[model samples]
Target: MAKQERAVRTRRLILEAAGAVFDEFGYESTTIAQILARAGVTKGALYFHFASKEELARGVLDQALTLEGILPQESRLQEWVDVGMVLAHRLPAEPLLSASVRLSADRKARDLFGTSWPAWIDFIAGQLAEAKAQGEVLPHVDPGATATLFVGAWTGVEILATAHDESGALEKRIALLYDTFLPGIAVPGALRNLDTSPDRGARVWKLHQAQHHARQEEAAAATA
Candidate 1:
């Protein structure tokens, strides 16, 4: 049991290290040697766990999805939105998720979707359907299409925000999107009393400012 646990831990380390390297250098440029060095594991051990680099890459992607909770299941639409927002905010702190997003943009990574994407989309669609049935969403809304659009919009915004390395801007964009988009689709009175509070927005802005300041301080310290 101890040996199995150790093996699992080692595999997780390799997956995380590989994901970071892949995020930093992309799939074509990343090498197994770099992953092994980062993980501090031997080639034999890596090979024992994964047959090839492709398999390892897939494992890295799978681990990322698991960590991010991207698979669709019994979660609600609001929960999905919240999870996506949290993931976006944490992307800067999570190299594995960043790498997963990068790989997801690749044509070859389509195969991974066979395992991850359907479950996630179906989950989102199910949530939307439930919302409609409960009269929380507008009766005319198409659940599947709305689910697809929501995922696309969120992913696009997240990618752009991450690319600019601007968490503050990202938060603002998301807030704007939620305020403008949700009301249009929500059932009458369902979200009428929603807080839509500026105070919340202000708090998010302040948090971003703090993060920005911390980054600058870290950079200065590195130079000092």
Candidate 2:
């Protein structure tokens, strides 16, 4: 049992290290040797767990999706919308998820659509269908189409934010996406007027500062 636990930990470490490397250098530029070195694991260890870089990439995706877990079984459309919003906001803050989004645009990754896109699309479609059935969306809204659009928009946003080194921009973008999409889907008379803007840039700035300070404090704590 202890050996199994250690093995699991080692696997997680490798995945996390690979995810960070992939995010920094991209899929094509990254090699298994770099991942192995970063994880402080032997090549043999890496090979034992994954047959190739492609398999490791799939493992990273699995870990990321596992982190998201199953969405709650909700009967309300509004509830599903809220859940989707949470997912959008959380993905940016997660390293493995961000890596997956980055890789989604790679030709090699797209070629592996048989392994990746279906599950992702189905997950989004399920959420959209739930929302539609709960009357959170317009009767005319196509759940599958909306789901595809949502995921596509998410991937695009992640790519743009990464290219600009604007991690803090994710929250505002998510809010904007929701604001833009919600009105069209909202049932008549079910929607209420509300201000969506909240000085997001300033809030993001403050949050970044807070994170920096927290990290500094943690470093100090570790050294002391």
Candidate 3:
């Protein structure tokens, strides 16, 4: 059990180190040596988990769909909003998320290792579809199409916000986007109930952290 836990930690360390390096330097410029230096792991250890640099890149990208900071809401549309908001709140501080975007933005890297955008799109579409089924969305709304465009719009906001390089800009932009876009697809009742505030993400993140810590404590007590 100890060995398994150690391996998991080491793998996570390697992935995080790789994400930071890839975020700073594009995938093409990143080297195994750099990743090892950042991770403080031996070459053999990295190779044990990842056969090659490409594998590391893919591993980082795989984390792109992480829904760690999102909490379930009464409305699935609100959950969808939370997804974007939480990502916006966390992306600046998270190398995994930032690195995923950087890698996806690179055409060569995207071709070599497929982007996680499709998975994210599918997840959002599932949310919208469920919302529609629950009568949260308008009858004319197409969940798949809305999801694709929303993803595109979110990507654009990410890029623009990163370019502006202002703190809290991404969150604000995403919140504004939800505010503007949701009204079109969501029914009046659902739209009124949605929380599109820029700070909604921060609040949700804090709640998630508190719950996660509580879970860890409960697990420790159980083992004790």
Candidate 4:
């Protein structure tokens, strides 16, 4: 059990190191040597987990759909809003999510290793579809189409946000995204009820961390 836990930690270290390198330098420019140096792990250990740089890139891309910081909401559209806002809130600090964006836009690496954009789109589409079923969205709103465009807009907005300001501009941009888009899709009642506050992400993250820590403590107590 101890050995397995150690391996998990090592694998995580490698992924984080590789993500930071890839985020800073495009996939084509990154080298195994840099990741090794950053991770402080042996070549054998690195290879054991990720055989190649492409695999490491894939590992990072796979993290694009994490729901870690989102708490369930009464409104599905609100839940979807939380998804984007939470990501924006965490983007400045989370290399895995940011690195995935960097890699996905790199033509060479994108052709070599596919992205998780479709997965994110699908997830959002499902949320919108559920909201529509619950009468929260307009009858004319096409969930799948809106999801595709929404995700695309998010990508473009994030690129602009990072380029313009490093100081909390991301959340505002994300909030703006919903401010502009949600009105067309959501019903009047729902739109009025929805909270697209930029600070929504930070608030959700705090609650999520509190719940997560409580869960850990409960598990530890049970095991003890």
Compare the candidates by lDDT and give the number of the best one: 3
Per-residue lDDT for 1-224 in model 2, tens only?
Answer: 69999899888888888887887887878999899888999988888888988887888777655313223333344444443445455565667777676666667765763234456667767767876766666888887888778777766765676667665576567667767877886675545632234243343345556777898999999999
What stretches of model 4 exceed 4 Å from their correct place?
none
Go through the candidates in order and give each one's C-alpha lDDT.
0.67, 0.67, 0.93, 0.90
State the TM-score for model 4. Answer: 0.94
lDDT tens string, model 3, 7-30? 999999999999999988888999
* Candidate 3 lowest-lDDT run of ten: 99-108
Report the candidate with higher lDDT, 3 versus 4. Answer: 3
**Quality of model 1 by C-alpha lDDT:** 0.67
Worst 10 residues of 2 by lDDT: 66-75
Model 2, runs deviating above 4 Å: 67-75, 113-115, 193-224
- List candidate 1 segments past 4 Å from native: 67-77, 111-115, 168-172, 193-224
User: Where does candidate 4 have its weakest 10-residue lDDT segment?
Assistant: 61-70
Task: Using lDDT, rank the candidates from best to worst.
Answer: 3, 4, 1, 2
Q: How close is candidate 1 to the true structure, as a TM-score?
A: 0.73
lDDT of 1 by residue, 1-224 (tens): 69999999988888888888877777777889998999899999988898877887788667555323333333244544554555555556667776777677656555544334555567678777887776678777898987777767766776787778764666666656667777767765766644333234344335666777898999999999
Report per-prediction Cα RMSD to one decimal: 9.5, 7.5, 1.8, 1.5
**Clash counts for all predictions:** 0, 0, 0, 0
Runs with alpha carbons beyond 4 Å of true place in candidate 3: none
